[model samples]
Target: MSDSEQPGPPEPDDSDPPGAEPSSRRGRRPEPIGDGVGAAHRTWLEPVRSRLVASGLTLDELVGRSGYSKTRLSELLRGKGYYPSWEITYSVVRALDLPPWPLRRLWTAAAREAAKKQGWIENRIQAVQPLGLEQPPVAHQAFTLAMRAPYAAYARAFLQAEDRAQRVVRETFDILWLTWDEACATADVKRHAWQMLRSRVMARTLQQDGHPDLRQAAFFTAAQAAIIDLAERSAHINKMAGFFDAVARLPQDQMDVIVLTHLCTIDAAAVPGIVGLSPAMTHTLDHHARGALNDLYRQHTWE
Candidate 1:
């Protein structure tokens, strides 16, 4: 059979009422809109969908308020088809009276994950100007300053460029600013901020065989602190490669602790604050991580 003759997914019936599920699509699962990005971006969509329900407005009402067709709104709400453009997404956001910047950030992230080009993303976002969302609160500014260096260090260790690291940190801070109230409500906002930074950096980090590929960072050796003779430096770099590979294989919690304390050289006393763990717990994880690395080293030596 020719490609053009192959059956495609059913199209929604325009005759169906604005909010009604198309009969053709009934009981058929919609393919996820942005599964390429992972679940975090999709989690951000849940609340926006809930907002439509919370408003108690029918789809017809949202159509009028958002100036978008009901069918379009339905697809956006269901995450059924193409990842909606920020222009349409923001219009619904405004109509729902929800906060815009956070959704915008998430939407942008999902769009990127969907492989949308930068020019398209930028053009869509420029359609709506978000006022009052531009300014970060005083507390956010203070936190950003205190956390900026360590966050950049952690990001650079994974991402390997000053510009990329700075961009990731800035995006993390912007997200933190949007969610400051929720972060402050937690036991430690610093830890909350760190997780946000970690998520952004790790999203950009390369993967190898289901683990983060940190071996590349080891070869990019100018960022390392140690200074040694030429031959020694080469040997040291090779040693660091094995160390980073081992670190990459560590469990998530252990890897976080190792990256922050051992690689970035943040003080152990301060780690609990950034990781949102109790000091004793941080110590335990660190000890376990060291033990695991030692075991890996011994196994390599034996082999």
Candidate 2:
């Protein structure tokens, strides 16, 4: 085919379907290649890393569980110039059950960078707003960056994992926190809390494995925050004992969920010796147990 035979430059059709902006360029402006954890990086990285460290997981375990290369992981931990691999970093972040704070920063930084590179950034032209108090390269927009999509996706997963972990811990323990002595005295509250506890423990474990259910991920942040503070401020033994005792009185059907799920740290399906119920029955028991426990709470002084 001759040069002329090749299709002439296609017209930029106005009817193009809306989508993400292409990473194309027309000007000579330098691409904002990520230099060593830029100004914004320093602001969040150290504290975030420290917070991860404080969570109950060790770096070695994180590496082993995440399949991250150990040498590289150490460099990131020290903030010594390694870019975090999302596959590993995100999982540990999720495993620790930290909030979405670090991931949010990652998203913000990416959007800012992407917008900066493509000045006047109009993607899909979804409803143009009259120029507010700011201009193109809006005051806030300048700080954003286009993050790697895989990394961004990983960030979302990490946050979800954290939520799942927190939710599991909280749902399992919330009743115990507000009501203990009564919880222990009644078989009903014991049964329901056990089921709730089992749900969360399973959730956290599932989150670590990378397939968390979003429906059950929201309550943990607030609930765990309060529970942790209470645990820290009061006598640790008091809290732990209260929780243990509450778990002790539940029925074989309901109580087994906590004994096998939370305290034993084993899944019902996997551990034949623990809570030998079929998966379907376990779920049914969970629903029924919650109702029975709530009724018990109404009668007893859980406070």
Candidate 3:
């Protein structure tokens, strides 16, 4: 089927007993639409608004610069009614000449919270028939799963360029859509999606860097130092910078272990499947990673 022919929700069967809802309605609570999400949405967009003001850019200027409609841009700044698309958010960031990192991070957090409040993922999942069923796969459902995957974590692990990371994520979803049937057969769809995304991101990073070894000592050091500098101002950012720096310094195997266990929060038994390490070896690597992080922290403090 063409990608444009998106699937609608399955038709309800009439065989159900009276007063019984569809199976999709079973055990699912109605999604909350309350003040919590609105507060988070406002919190996330406040910085964007502040930056735009500080940059001396008006909504009209932003609309002209970003090529987005003034109404859409205004809606995004107000953070009400609808969650803005990533494209719109990115355009606004570019128009304001703001550093994308912190704003992107805030946007991600806010978007995720808003999605949860609305039960967006659950609603999307329920809208489609089960994978590998008689019906053809739904393009929108596949896209939703890909969007909900941890592309950000993989992007952080391999690439520093925000635009490149975004591209990788978009490509990951495209590939997922193409391979939807194959993915449905997997026992763990989310893990399969993550692996596919990681491999693609890693390959892209390797191609772009053109270095025999993608992980360069100088590059890691520089990136870590920048994180550390940010850490000086915020205690939370400091802890995160130290953790990322230490992870970056680890050997490839140990780094994979830490990322899988800590970042991905995968179980120890599952590490072997993902990284080809034994459970025992995974535990050992975790122990060593901790020690290495401690040592790195001390060294940073001393220096």
Best by TM-score: 1
**Candidate 1, residue 53: how far the Cα is off, in Å:** 5.2
| TM-score for candidate 2, residues paired by index | 0.24
Across residues 1-303, which tens digit of lDDT does each residue of candidate 1 receive? 544335444435434364765333223333345444345456456666655665677776777788877677777777767677787788888997766776787778777777666777776787777546455678888887888888888888888889999978877776676556667988778777777788888888898898888887667655344665777777767787887898988998899888888778798898887777899999999999989998877643311
Worst 10 residues of 2 by lDDT: 139-148
Which residue ranges in model 1 land beyond 4 Å of their true spot?
A: 1-47, 50-61, 80-83, 102-133, 137-139, 177-188, 220-232, 295-303
Tens digit per residue, CA lDDT, model 2, 1-303: 543234433322223235733332322222232345553343334444655545545555655665655444555555454334343345545555433333433423433433322221222112232323422223212212221222122223324454544433432233233233334456554344444444434333333123333222223223334655664634443444444344434554665554444433454464232233457778776566556655544433222
How much is 175 displaced in model 2, in angstroms? 30
Residue-level lDDT for 13 in candidate 3: 30
Per-residue lDDT for 1-303 in model 3, tens only? Answer: 433244434423313245643232222322233343464455446556655655665555666788876556655666545666555677776676654444444555566666533344334334533323222247536545544445555465567666777766765554554346556777766657667766766665644233212332224443355655554535544555555655665775677677656655556676665544466877898888878877766544312
Model 3 Cα shift for residue 255 (angstroms): 2.2
- Look at candidate 2 and tell me the lDDT of residue 15: 30
Q: Residue 86 of model 3: what lDDT?
A: 54
TM-score of 1: 0.71
